[model samples]
Target: MNDTNIKWDKIFYGRAWIANIIDIIQTKDILQSFYFKRYLLRAMMAGFIISIITVFVLMVKTTFSLDWGPGLVNMIGAITFSFALVLILFTNSELLTSNFMYFTVGLYYKLIKPYRVLNIFMLCFIGNIIGACVLFGLMRLSDVLTPDMVTMLDQTIETKIHTYTFQNILVRAIFANFFINITLVIAMQIDDVVAKMFVMMFGVTIFAFMGYEHVVYNSCLFVAGLFYEVDHLALWPALKNIVASFIGNYIGGGLIIGLFYAYLNDHGQFKTHRNK
Candidate 1:
């Protein structure tokens, strides 16, 4: 680890994480050239990569379901899902869920314009959708999924989009991203790779096992379900789920965590005993 990592490892306890989060938010605001088109392209590429990886992991989860018990099965799925975010973070890629925190923090700090942040979000969202559609199409054409796997995916589709009411979907999504982004922020505050991975896995596993909705991951899964002609997985219903998840994720990550933390940290309300 470097000096910054060493310093953080020594002092990253309690509310000290707030200082670290603020420093990271400020660093992203200062270093990222968000106004440039190249940066937009980079964001798109990052979202694209994340979508592809997400689909692969979901496929693994659905395909191997018969071999493991329900709890272990979900655990395996969550672990693989957590790996996708880990790769995104370590590679410096943009994920919309995580970016929600960044954009919110930047806006609160007056370091980024609202319009610019929205543009970043739109670009990344579109990119992720496009990537997901491509992967689904490819998987369908290649006959990659077995009939049993397709059935399993269809059941998941029913569970995610069809069974839940709009309100139910929105609420679950809120809690899902709430825990996810919290994990993200905590992991970002830490320096050790092992600790970071462990925390991320635990947080992601909690949400995944709870069957919470996430916009990007669901985009791919629903599209793949649609492509496979899964029952009740229509375009309109899937779209509704996606939109509700997006809103809930924004609330959970952007407002709940980002705005809340920024407010407390800015007003010097984060000085717990550990910091002193």
Candidate 2:
């Protein structure tokens, strides 16, 4: 076959990117329409899993930071932290960051309405917060917050809230979800479980190690801080970071990746293929 006639999906070893995007929209439609309770539960589950993993990452980093220092500690923490996304994806949990891309694509194709998108976003965000709070309460009850762990969390929160400029947080937030959703989009076109896990780990680790802001992860951290008597954590600054991260994540994932891909692949040729 000529290059122009090549079956691109075969080259990708799975469905084409546009096909994957359509599949995501259809799958989400069913869940959102008939199984919304489950959808909300999955969002909460994602928040819970991330919160638990964040604590473990802080604990591990705290233990190693003294001997390994910041660079190595961050690398280790990043790698360890990545498993949270892996778990979330495998469990079919809903994450706001990835959803930013998914729903944006759905919107582009007129598969979902704007108001419904906003509703889903709000529901996922609120559910994530609820999940984070529940995890914090469980940790408190279990008495798992050690002095070092608390200290680590406080320091982390301080950097996120007080140390960085608003512009810095915004940029970092953009890159964070950009990496995450890019990984998700590519992973959707692959079939191997191990490959998907590796892609997720690599993408998450890059963002974590770079100290990029993620809205959901930041929410979990902030919730933990509220549960504890943290020295450096303040309400206003935390809110600022959250707001900046939320906007930046939408720009990066929804506009940059989702719209760009939809526009690229949903032109005349793909529409004709779809009609066929």
Best by lDDT: 2
TM, every model: 0.80, 0.91
Instruction: Please write out the lDDT profile of model 1 over residues 1-276, one tens digit for every residue.
Output: 444334333443434665565665555554345445554444555555655665665577776777778778777777777777677677765577888986787677666578877877777677666666766677777766777677777878888878888788888888888988889878867789999988987888788778888888888777677677777688778889989999999998999988886665554344342253
Evaluate all candidate structures by whole-model CA lDDT and list the values in order.
0.72, 0.86
Q: Candidate 1: minimum summed lDDT over ten consecutive residues — where?
A: 5-14
Candidate number of the best TM-score: 2
lDDT (tens digit, per residue) of candidate 2 on 45-150: 9999999999889889888988987898989999999999999989988889999998887787777779888888888898888899999989988768888899
Model 1 misplaced stretches (Cα beyond 4 Å) = 1-41, 44-59, 62-64, 268-276
Report how far residue 266 has shifted in candidate 2, in Å: 1.6
| TM-score: model 1 vs. ground truth | 0.80
What root-mean-square deviation over C-alphas does model 1 reach?
6.5
